[model samples]
Target: MGKIVGAAIVSHHPGLMQCEEFRRAMGAGEDSDLIAGYSRLRAKIEAAKPDVVMILDSHWFTTGYHLVDGGARYTGTYVSDEMPWYLHGVPYDYRGHPELALAVEAVSRERGGYNRAICHPGLERQYATLNLIKHLRLELSDTPVVSVSSCQNCEWQHFLASGDAIGEAIRRSGLRVILLASGALSHKFNGIDWKPNHPRLFHESNVSSIENIQSDKGAIALMADGDHQQVLERWQDEYRQLPWEAFGAHYLQMVGAMGGRECRAKGEPLSAYENARGTGNIHIWFQP
Candidate 1:
């Protein structure tokens, strides 16, 4: 049977990729400390040597249906429509896993969560996805990847169900998988381009997020026990998480698919300023 050997919730706040001056100003140094957390995840991935890396990014959005990149290869230069200056002309080259994408589609459909499988001769990578591939150095890993869209306009519950379907598919496919959810905690942004070490924009910043993660030892602890409803209630009450675009929805799929297992974090976090915008960035990881 296929198994989820590794899973991570990483931040992709653009600055983690496109903002070097901002990082230097804030003392993030040459290598972004926030993205440094991905190294541990990378190590776990290397050890497990997963067959496919399945990433569900908020930016992989579709208007009407949950979609998968079912293409055979994804190669192109990426530029963010939102912020072109920071993320311009990003070259990306990666292989796609059409089989796994189709499997996810079948599973979602079987579970009554409709999905779309889209393939093209050549497909472009979204900004968030490009950041992940570059930061994690996934292009060098030789593992095929499948990206899923957190469908636009779908109810939050739809994402939850889709996550369940994904987990089910992974467990049964007999293909090792690594799941990554790219997002941030509190996604409100600051209008001004604040300098480095700018304080978080929201009242409930990384402290609140870490405390919540600590209480459960990671959100997956609560979610793994099928207490996802309780998890949703707590998140709503404690943190009015506004996903950066499709951010919250992206993570909802990860949390829903956790299957009641804890992904204990390792070592100290590589926390950094989320961006010039008022958000918090914490680099967290779990052992395989």
Candidate 2:
């Protein structure tokens, strides 16, 4: 199997597209920031020479557990003014990558009673990123690409299974390296009536919660006790303390799930661009 060499967690906030201040700092053109980040991120993957790259997003699937089909299927749910679509049937090109699609279908079939519902209707940026990745895969010959959405139905285990599948596929394909996982850290909404200057807000506090959980001493323990409320409360306490620069927690959780692999190297923060509206990018890297 190809070894995982690098990983990163990034937030795909929509405001990134409008943040011109960030563009100038990153020396980027007028294209979308999501596209730029993906380009830079893909460059890192190519430099690492990994066999596979996996991108995880928190806002993809619905919360439901039902076995549908198996093998490589492009099943997704979309909510946009341009195309409002929900795909429940098998993909037309099931024969292209039948095994992986079969695995997903089997899991969906076995996990019945899955609550498949959309939580938000405005997360078009995620769908845009998904399309961008697909386009990149078609244009680039250096790496085999796989993408999965972690909508409500997906748990940590599901993500782990997907990673395992990618590893297995790469081994079978005779690739020597894999670049797995991309996401971000704690992200509190701006609508909560909280100020960045509040004493409770900062990166250290956010990192503490993540470190605590990763160390197996934080809310995960409470979650184990089935005390989701307590876990939520504890997280809320931490979230209330976060500063503007550290608003990437939701993305971080997805990255942490794909742990146990070494990063190639870590990059310095490229830029810290903030706007009058209080959203920006923290461009850093973890090369495996």
Candidate 3:
């Protein structure tokens, strides 16, 4: 039977695409330690050898209902309109898991989550999905993938339910899967003109919250115990207001999809750093 062999919740910043020398020249590498941390994460994923990687991309924003890319092949060039200088002319090609995507949509709908699968050839893959291949060296042909969007108009519970439904569907379909929540923990950016080779800029309000999230070990602990409600409450009260990408729901979706009942800490904390705009980027791994 197909099973979820492993899972990860990591940062997906455009800065991760820079060369080591560029990262050094920019002086951003020292503070975040993202290279070493992600290196370890990549090794762990390689060892798992999962059949597919399902990315919960925060950059994908759908209205009203959740959407999945049902295309059999995903190919595109992603030149970040926001920062073409840093991310221009980037190309990506990946094999898609259309059957599994449709399964997820049907299961989510049955669970009352109301998600759908979409197929549009020649569409550009968003940075949220592209960064997975670019930074982690994940090949789509080797490990087929399905991309899910974080809907714009959904309640907190809806997000959690969708995750649970996806997890169940993956199990039912017997496909080995990995869940990746691709986003930052805190997200207050400097103006677009900020240079790349500088210490990340920080806003006053989010700094402490970023630090708090870094220190909190209960994220995995809460999910392991099936205390998703507590996890949700803690996130809202402690870190949600700090302006995380996708309101930090990406992490919860991952936790809930793991069945939200592990009841013990399973994650190995990885790295934490500030994004270009002074937001927190944390990485953690769970082996279930």
Among these predictions, the greatest lDDT belongs to: 3
Q: Which stretches of candidate 2 lie over 4 Å from their true place?
A: 15-39, 65-128, 131-143, 151-184, 192-283
Residues 117-173 of candidate 2: C-alpha lDDT, one tens digit per residue: 222222223442344344345224534344445434454334444444443443444
lDDT agreement with native, every candidate:
0.66, 0.37, 0.71
**1 versus 3: better TM-score goes to:** 3
Tell me the TM-score of model 3.
0.85
Model 3, 1-288: lDDT tens digits are: 777787877887787777777776555334346667777888888888888889888888889777878888877777897678988888777788888889889898787776788877665577878877767777733678788888888766677777887888888888888888888766666555644433433222333343544534345455445465676667657656555678766776777787654423366767654454555566777787
Which window of ten consecutive residues has the lowest lDDT sum in model 2?
Answer: 87-96
Q: Relative to the unseen true structure, what is the C-alpha lDDT of residue 87 in candidate 3, on a scale of 0 to 100?
A: 87
Ranking 1 against 3 by lDDT, winner = 3
| Per-residue C-alpha lDDT of model 1 across residues 1-288, encoded as one tens digit per residue | 888776766777776674656666544235456655667667767888888987888777778888888998888888889888777888888889887788888988887776767887476577667788888888987678888887878877777777777888888889888878776655555545434332432122332234433433444454344455565766554443443347477767775666522322232334443332555455444333
